[model samples]
Target: MSIMSGFCQISPAGLCVYSNEQTSSITGYSSEEMLGMGWVKAIHPEDRHRVVAKWKKCNANRDTLGTSFRLLRKDGEVVWVIGQIAPFLAEDHRVLGYIATLSDVTGRKKAEKALQLSAERFSKAFNASPSMMAIYRLADDRFVDANNSLLEAAGYSRAEFVGRTVTDLPFWVEEKTRNSITGLLQGKEAVHNLEGRFLTKTGEVRIGLVSAEVIELNSEPCMFVAINDITEQKRAEAAIEVERRRLFTVLHNLPANIALVEQDYSVRFANNYFCESFGESSGKYCYEALYGRKTPCEACRIDKIFQERVSCKWEQVHNGRPYQLYGYPIHDIDGTPLALTMSIDISELKQLKEEMLRLDRLNLIGEMAAGIGHEIRNPMTTVRGFLQFLGAKKACAGYKDFFDLMIEELDRANAIITEYLSLAKNKNIELKEQNLNFIVKSLFPIIQADAMLADKYVALVLGDIPALPLDEKEIRQLILNLARNGLEAMVPGGTLTIRTYNDADKVVLEVQDKGQGIAPDALKKLGTPFFTTKDKGTGLGLAVCYSIATRHKAKIEVKTDSGGSIFVVQFQRKSPVAPQMN
Candidate 1:
């Protein structure tokens, strides 16, 4: 019989008596060769003995036999087969030959072997992985298995972890996180990078990124989870953020304009002062936002920083105030070019430097004037008396006009000498308790007469001030010199204002002129002896004013702009001294 299965009849002695075509094809042997041959000979050696014993017993007992074994073919190949045999007995109940049917099952056996090999490989890889991994049975929500990484992370042994549910362990620090993960898994949706807090057995918390998916294990659905610990990374980020805030606070409060500009001329960052000065310029073009220009400024300082890729320092003027700017080429972590700029107001510093230079010049002149002033004045007074005597004599009446001009020149020379002597550091002065406002009020009439002669107006404003030690004559001279200078500097109809007030612990006298401001170059030389801006000026007028101010232990400060100028004299307040009783 040639059906789906091979058919063969065996003799009572377990020998093959007859075989069908399918039997010959399955065994790789012909029917003639199999006749009277022991069928046990075709069974593989590994199963031949067991199969022969079972076949003999089944034939003797007149019962059916069922078995599966590897059969050897004629070509030396082995095939897996399953067979069912039934005894065909005679009416006398004696022993009879057996009829057997065999079917090929090699394909099923090979598939089962491949599947076992794959499972073995997967188990080895899962246990050896470095990332924490675990499997939980879906039916009971219990851990079926956990890798070594997961055990070390959770502070548990495999024996203690297996068969334990999520509730039985202190794993997820928050219950909601655990519930969320469970819900996702139950819905058969994958959880990808679900960040959460995890707790170890020692109660230490750790940040982790968890991912999970449903997988089949042991013919049942289970959840496979992977966790990546990121506790250190998170802590480092927080520390960096705190440090950034501290640095920002320091820059914000600094008394300078600080900014970071990108290569595109856009403002990346600006400190509080810079923002207040420029009006919130973040993300805006530096030139347009800061300077209010439609185009980039010519010879821009920050531009040079990027072009040269170096640091630079320069002075610039903004809103009539001078600032010293420092710019540096900088790059970020990504290597993007930028410019870091800081601008500090240097207006007061420049003024102080100029003042020091002027003082140095004054000291040098004072030393020279003290040595020569008295010598020059003695000769000039003697010459002035001789000239006056000659002008009155009849013999020299014809030369009277010449003598009068000579005497007048001699007097002018003597006056200049007196002004020079006042510059001497050891010049004697009489200090008395006198009110500065009273002194200013007393001098206003003379000042007004001079302003009227120059076709200018004069105004006086006096505030309440306590009396202080002052040299009355020196104060009068100081007031006259400053007032005359102010009157000369203005045009017709220009007003001159004189003001006196108490400023802090000092007294302030301000002389203001409504005239074109002094030039910057000349401003630095204002109090230097022999430095003058007027054509008719002997240049000793302001020098004498400065000398008188120095003698009184006062400070002179000048403020000027395009509109006008103000000369301020600050006098230190002093206590009155007790008079000696005769």
Candidate 2:
């Protein structure tokens, strides 16, 4: 009776009744051969028993039989079918044949299985979602079908929420939400997420950001909304704004020339006083802006600090007006150099610094020359007389050994003079951009060898180093001298630490030695030439370091006691590059 109807003729045993032509083609048998075959033989193997039982039940009752089962084709593959079989009778109501209607059920069965699997995957995704979410009805009201996060927060069972309107929830503030919805329905446009408030089940007010869009669910009108909690973020932003304004107000009252430079060192912000102090129309470089020139002036103290990774102080002529300046780099949150700068005009202080330097340099040179002159000259005169006497005499018994010892003393005197000259005289350092840390790393192995000879252990505690204009050769020499000193200071099996890093506004290099640390008096005399505390020692190493540091405008700081000696070199950034002479 269905629109999709077909008929079949079967015996009471449920087998296809075909004409002679069809029987031979389908069964690979002639009509006579099929007539003797059992109807169950043509039925699918798995369905054969069930089909046979249904046939017997229908025949005994003389009623219609309906069932869906699989039948075997001539090729032995199963084909799904739905069938209605009824008894065919003669006038005496005796069964003669069977009539049946059938339709293929294979496609329908496959589709039903596919639909079931799709539903299972959707269910899993909905339940396992981390975000608070749900399906909603657009026509009736904003109704939540399910939400695990909501259930946990609201303490509501699924049955309590499903088929229930969000408006009826007392915490939702129905009046406000309905007004917004009415506006959306009138416009028929999507509403972006906006901040709103909600009342919790326990009646506590909470903030939320929400947005909704029109959608089709099951071929009907609906809406899908996503909500997020942002109460803390809102509070933090307001507090930050208030603090920022307060700080800005105070910063505008600074007395010195301070400017906020961009990452590229360009003048992004300059105060009214800074503009009055240093005019505009300067080049991009910070030095060019302050000094009004393409190249840095000679004896650039700031440049030396940055270049040599040390501190320096000096006075320079800007347009013939000497400005005693001290400048250093600013560091950002991650300790990277920033373009921010603070400078003060110390022109009046220039005369005081020059006088101090002159007195200090003279006093240093005078004390050093006086202390060594007597001992050095006395020893040399004795060694010279012994050598002259030895040369005057012929080689006698033990004379050669005595002569050798005298010559060794002579060589020691000469070595002292050479070291003193190197220490006091300022050799051209050839300041250029260099990695101080690289110089340290490259010379570490040589330092280790020196330590081995001294029977001491060395430790390298390397830190951060930023690239700058420096002389690799000079820094290498400086590091070599310090490391050698560290080894000599340490007793047998003592440790040494060589560390490098940027210390705030300065590039810092420190050499720490665990040994019989220098005495306070010895430490004070460190930068004076020929002030050695060791036997057979030329005490010009630290003096030469001080000379090199001054020439490069770098600073040498010492921390020494019995525990150990730590020599820290700090360099200021924003110093100009020194020119190379051919």
Candidate 3:
């Protein structure tokens, strides 16, 4: 007997009388030990009674019987086996003993059990999954199985779905979709995310992404398809895309520079102003692209915003003009941090603020001067007259020089008071259609005389200009004060040039002096009362000039550099409706 199968002989009592080596190996019992031993003892307890009953039945009938049962080995292991028992008979056909054979089916049994387990798992998973799934018989393309998700999504009962073909249900809204999927299955190809429209039992069309693969079901080729319903997702995505485009349009046209920056200091998006100011910066570091720097700027605030998770505002000067920058922290839907940075030019705004403050100070000083001018000067006048009257007497003749100096000092004080009063916002002014060149010429002699005394040369350049409303007296004072300041700013032999010209709808008078440029700090405070740049200067000259210019609706603009400084007063060519008065 082959060792793969166990063989044994049993007597009428069903006790093993002889056995092959295979039987000893299969039962882990030697032939001598198994002799006279009941063969039923080797059968597992759970299968013993049934197997013994069958063995006795076969012996009584004197026929062969086959059965499968578990055997308990001496090693304490259970082995499955299928065995055949043949009854040995005498000439009268009376059963005497039996011959038995057994083949081990343990490996095949384990394999079958594993297959059953896998099928059970697949069924549970297929039914429990939320994804819509269906199996179709490849031979006829008929639905063999469908999960609950598919039945609910398609509005179909299991009875209505299982036996129907794709065409019978008319499921796919497009014929091409059906043909394509069928073709893929026939060609042994898997379909992945083939988007198509399909109809429900209610005739409603729904969008779905179909993915399928060929699988074996019940020993026959079948198509297993999984569909993902994306109708709402697609619609939401479309709406989000539309909103994104609308926001892009709004930002792109904004007047200020706007940019979206990532944590890596890279520019994610830039508006028109940003792109035009810094060139194309997408996918590049912000500092390197916007400012042409190899590293981040020392004063950069963007990094601080990211690290601290806050917004910020600051002012900076770019190319000699003031700019205000604002930073706001933002996050994406996934919670990625980003920054929205905006920069706006504030040069004109800053200048306007400064001008307002300066005018406020001038008005305050002017009011003080107008309120107390005569009251203070009257006593000084009376003292001067008494001093002169006393000096002419013989008793006070020795103090005549002192008396003259006192009277001169008083006159200087009175002159300062007059200049201060001129700064009053409502100071009276006579406005007439007058030629600026004529006024400049009339004052040229006095300006030249003063320049000569200061050992400075003076030159005049007059251009053809339209006549403008002017207060000749105040115009003369404005010219003299500016010319004297110019003459004082230079050393001996330095030249001062005064010029008048026409500048589109306005008349311009410019005083040019070859002096070192004014310092930036001092330049800002130029028009405020008592704000002086000179050691012996009263500082009211320029203040009064600004006031006079305001009364005439003119603008004072200054341009200065290391080479020289120029003070320009431009008068609008329109006449005032009436002379201004206080």
Candidate 4:
């Protein structure tokens, strides 16, 4: 048999041959033709001696032995073979030729070679991958698998991370971190992309987003985690938090008051100023804080607020200080009412208001003086010329005395015109600090005469008022205007009630009238120019009342209905430019 069969058979001494299907498989030959071939011919020329020696070992022990040897196929291609040989025994147990079997093994060998090449490629890719990747043992959380990227990020060697559970050297984490990882493992939540801190080997901490998944490795569960450094995001978040705190400080430390309220009537939140304004009364109800009484205030402003759902303004005295309370209602995150309220100390504001009203009055007086001067000056001039002409005429003797008397009257009329001019340009007002008590007390005698004019149905009721700094002339004017308006408003007459009191900061004056009510539309215009509702009304009565109240830094409030109207003036003692001296 030729070795070209790739599995020729022969004995150790080259005796009769015996072979099997393995020889046909390797050489691609028919088994019947190969069964008689010498085994030596199956060996390649270079491997014949090695093959003979390996078979000799098998022959001596009469047992099968396996070995690798090269052979030639019938197509003359060299292929690898794994052959097993055993010595065949005679029926009487004498010596016999060697029996053997072979496998092509070439396909298997080539497959192994390809597998080795693929493994090398995968190892290279794993080392070069950008994402920090690691493999951990599922049972113990030991680092079993890792790419070079993970080593660079962790600043640790393969040995440093390998045996250590996340507990050991902690190349990328600490003990607490390890516990968190253990919890994740137990819960099997497969936590991912969680930014956390890690301590390096040199004790420097690094921030990273660690993403991981649990999987089975070599039949045991393990975690494959990928970590991405994101220290910048952490820094950004910290900066934003700092900025937020600064803004909050600006609002909370304001000089005035600021408060945060819910849509409900309850007080939900407040700032430092708010806390100071309300004192310990914060966290109570909004209405209850201002009034110590049981129910909400009768003059509560929220009723108007409910109609418009917008910012609202009101005046109230809190802790002896008058405040202009402004409330703004906004929407919270869930699109619900987030109410904010602020109280600005308006004691100075009162004085500003008074100054404005006084200026308005002077302006009106100037107009009236101009109009009156134009109307009366021409008439008086005619009277003066006629009187002069009459004196020169002897035939007009009877008219002389009449003309003379008219001229004298004209002089008096001209003098009155001059006074009206002064009233028109009325800037020079004497501001004297006077007593409200004395002023009201002085008006007691005239109350009877005013009532007599209104058929005596109107009664004047006086009460003691705080004697504070005021302009006595203006105070008197203020009372006369109120008394006069009350009588006029009630044709049938009504009671006139004037009362006064004082807190630590301000003096309060009230004038209530039980007469025809002032319409709501005409309320704001009361203190303004040309605002009145009466026949032959100059609209200057209440405007004058406004002027008097304003010179004293007072605010006028009018409440009216079918029943009557109450006009109240609140005066503050302190001012910005100069305090009023009584």
Candidate 5:
């Protein structure tokens, strides 16, 4: 036999008869010590009984046997050996003895054990990982294994995905993504942080960062993919972007000057209006940008905001323009404090408030004038009657002319008082349903006569309109007053237009004059008592017109251009009846 193989001959009773030099070399035993020892004694103590029973069975049957067992070496080391035993025969076909050959296989067994341990460790790590992980066969993209995280993320059970291919599962949001991944894998590319979209079992698309590499699993080429779901992170980023755009739009389009300032009074951000007005004054003091001062203003509200953590407001004037300033404290996501300031132009509002005060004063004066007129009319009537009685007496012939003149002056004074009394606050109004066009037509003759006296023309353009609740006498007075005013404002050949029309839900009575427009100053005071442009006029005409319009719940609007002026009185188509006089 070859010297490399350990050869031994045993009696049919399973005792060792002879042993080769290779036996001592393989088992670390001397030839003298192993010659008479039973072959079972060379077997490892843990495997001796099983080998002895198998050897006895083979001897009795006179059959050949092949098996592997461990041997206890003389050095106390265990060695794996593969053994083949056979029964030797004589020429007469009778069994002689058993011969066996043994080969060492310790290194191969150790290598197999190491591979099994490595596979177990890999399985534990893959399943215990937090990331979604899966192993798919590269040949057909079939899922071979998946971790618990992967199953949960995909909203699928292990049974649903273990035997399915990528195409069988609704994993990819777009088919193109699958094709791209396949091509990259085929090219032996390592996918690192590749962003892709995936679909869950519930048909939800999730954004994921995927990493994959080609690996050998169970001796077959496969892909090991790791996915990190970033769907929530991506959505949060998108919403933040939208909010940023919205904030920028609001800041850019705001009519007021808005700015963000730091605690040091340095401007951090400024809107477009602020930048345009302050000449790109970021990083400068607020007073320096707004008032051209070197230091902060005495009215700085930023200090108050930082101290109280609340909003503050004040008014200031810059370059003769009024401004209302406001300040607020804001905190960032990290709790860093910031100051927001806004300045709005209030110059027009200021002027309007002053104008309202003046109007209020005028209304008070008008009320006083009405009360005084009521007292003066009674004595004036008695004085005018006595003057008429004295002028008719024969005994006062010398002073007859003086008496007549006094009575005439008294009557003129009474007429002026009557016009003033018309502006009283508590005038009784009797509102009833009346045709506006019919009212205009009834007053047309008077309007025409007034226009003819001034060598002007009167045109009545009446339209079919709905009946409105109005006091008939007051409406006639308003038409006559407006028509006469129009006629007086026109030139000799100019036209005075009286037009009645239905506009929207109201009836409009328009009186237009083809004369030079009123002066801006006089136009503003049109309804003030005793305010008029005519030399001999008491401004009570337009004032009375406005008062009557107020009592009837109508609006009076005047439009004047360089060519002419138009006064429009719009009355509601349906209005409640006004209270009658007691």
Candidate 6:
């Protein structure tokens, strides 16, 4: 029926009699050569015997026969062909000649062989893949084929999976999952890494990542799926999350300010105390949040922590508060290096330590002074009486001036001994409750006169204060000494300020001077006996004041800067009444 076919007429003995134009084109032989010699001469040597046997059978039975074989062309090339022969019958029912039809089928044969090779390669790869693979018919949702991995993953045999639908097998943990997959396939949507739970034959539930695509198998639409197990990975992630939450809880309730900082000084995590002190510091530079500075602090120790891989500690003062900072290097699970810093407020602790040391020194000095004062007074009194008696003799008038000078020197020495006796351990004094404002009012006149003499101003900022149990004589001495010291530290036209107020549960008395501040070295030694900055003056003024404050159970705090200095004495609300020590 197609023009590609070739036709020829052959005798019963298999010689070519009549040939069409297509026969010459198909075999590369003209009718002149083929008709005389015979069409059997064109048969390939390899197929010649088989084709001749079929031809002889067709001739003997006069039945239609078809066969395929390779043909040798006029140019010695071999071609595959399909041929059919039928008997040409006469009126008497005897065969006249055979009618044969031939066609060139080489192109179709080559295409079929290529397809077979491709299918073999695909089968090998699918079975050898590590990931589970399956192919199911989309129409019936029945599994058509499954690889060894897929059978192993489900703990099933190949026979158990081949003809079964997903619903018939224990594959999906939920019925809704299968429905969702079907919906996606029907919509022609490819699924990628869709998570689903699966149940194996052993009743084990496993989490899997499934990917599916619609493909054609044997001219029928099918679904090809690949599954990867992710149960262990999911469990590991959950455990890490729990640990992270526990760490956060511990850091949140800690008393000190804690934070995690990166190499660029950026804060990665800040605990509750750190956030409360610095205010929402995450993603901000450490220096900017902690010190309100635009640049990093000059003494940052984060680099040292990284280099040494150990903890480092230092002290810093910020906004009139002291903090002890400790930093340690830490690496995250991903091995990224970071600094963990903890800052503790040590301002009050440090002040208390200094106060204790000062009190210990005062007590030690008082014991030594009391012992020496008594020994010097008796000898000084005898010398003063001898000098007076010598000045009174008329015969000694020429030496009277010398005797008077000697008496004056002896009196000066006796006065120093009396001052030292004030620091004795057993001196007796009475304690009485008195209003501090009344005492300040009484001292104002004397303090103002001294300030006026120096051409300085004195201000009395007295607030309402409670009555304090005090020895009025000792309290009076403490106030005057501090007030006169303030005046002396200032120049003419400078102001000396005295303030009294209640702070927390304590009563505060403050003395301020507007002048060049005390030298750093001198400030540390201010209350030490015989330590004075002024020449031609006794250094016992501040020492005696400190001793009075110690007897009253008060604390002396000093703050100095480039502008001036302030000395504050804090007394407890109720004083312990005991014998006052000199």
Query: Highest TM-score, which number?
Result: 1
Deviating ranges (above 4 Å) for candidate 2: 1-6, 19-81, 87-97, 142-144, 171-197, 205-211, 228-582
Candidate 2's C-alpha lDDT? 0.66
lDDT of 2 by residue, 1-582 (tens): 554555446674545564344334434456555554555676677887898798789788888878877766667656667767789988988888887665667688778768788777866776766545566786777565666865655566778767777678654544676468547856887766666676666776666676667767778877766557666677776787677556545544676665554444455455555667777622365556777666655765444444554544566666645655555555433354534445566754653465346336634664565456556767777877777677666665457677777778687867666455444433445667777777777888889888888788878777767776676766776787888888887779898899878777788889998877788666656665567887966667677676666656677777787798899887776555699999
lDDT string for model 5 (332-392, tens) is: 4336687889999897786566545544655676687667887998999999998888888
Candidates 4 and 5: which is better by lDDT? Answer: 5
State TM-scores per candidate: 0.76, 0.43, 0.72, 0.56, 0.56, 0.63
lDDT of 4 by residue, 1-582 (tens): 344333445565664354455567677667676655566775799988988787677667776778888887777888888776666678975556555556667887889889889778867876788877788886776788688877877788888777778656556555655566668868868777776787766777888877777876557888877777766667776787688567668878888777656545566656687677666555677777655656666655654554578888888786656888787876543455656777788877765675566566756776787777778798778869978897769988878888788788788768656544543444345765666767777886786577776675534444444456676766777787787787677755466777777755667677777787988667646665556688866566676676566556677777788888888778885544677799
In lDDT terms, which candidate is top?
3
Angstrom error at residue 295, model 4: 30
Ranking by lDDT: 3, 1, 6, 5, 4, 2
Model 1 accuracy (lDDT, Cα): 0.86
Relative to the unseen true structure, what is the C-alpha lDDT of residue 72 in candidate 4, on a scale of 0 to 100? 77
**What is the C-alpha RMSD, rounded to one decimal, of candidate 2?**
23.5
lDDT, candidate 4, equals 0.69
Tell me each candidate's RMSD, in Å, in order.
5.8, 23.5, 6.6, 10.6, 11.9, 8.1
Q: What lDDT does each candidate get?
A: 0.86, 0.66, 0.88, 0.69, 0.84, 0.85
lDDT of 1 by residue, 443-494 (tens): 8898999888889999888888788789999999998999899898899999
Q: Where does candidate 4 stray beyond 4 Å?
A: 1-133, 136-142, 145-153, 165-198, 203-232, 248-365, 371-426, 452-475, 491-493, 503-508, 527-531, 547-555, 570-582
Question: How many clashing pairs does model 6 include?
Answer: 1
Candidate 3 displacement at residue 148 in angstroms = 3.2
Clashing pairs in 6: 423-582
Better of 3 and 6 by lDDT: 3
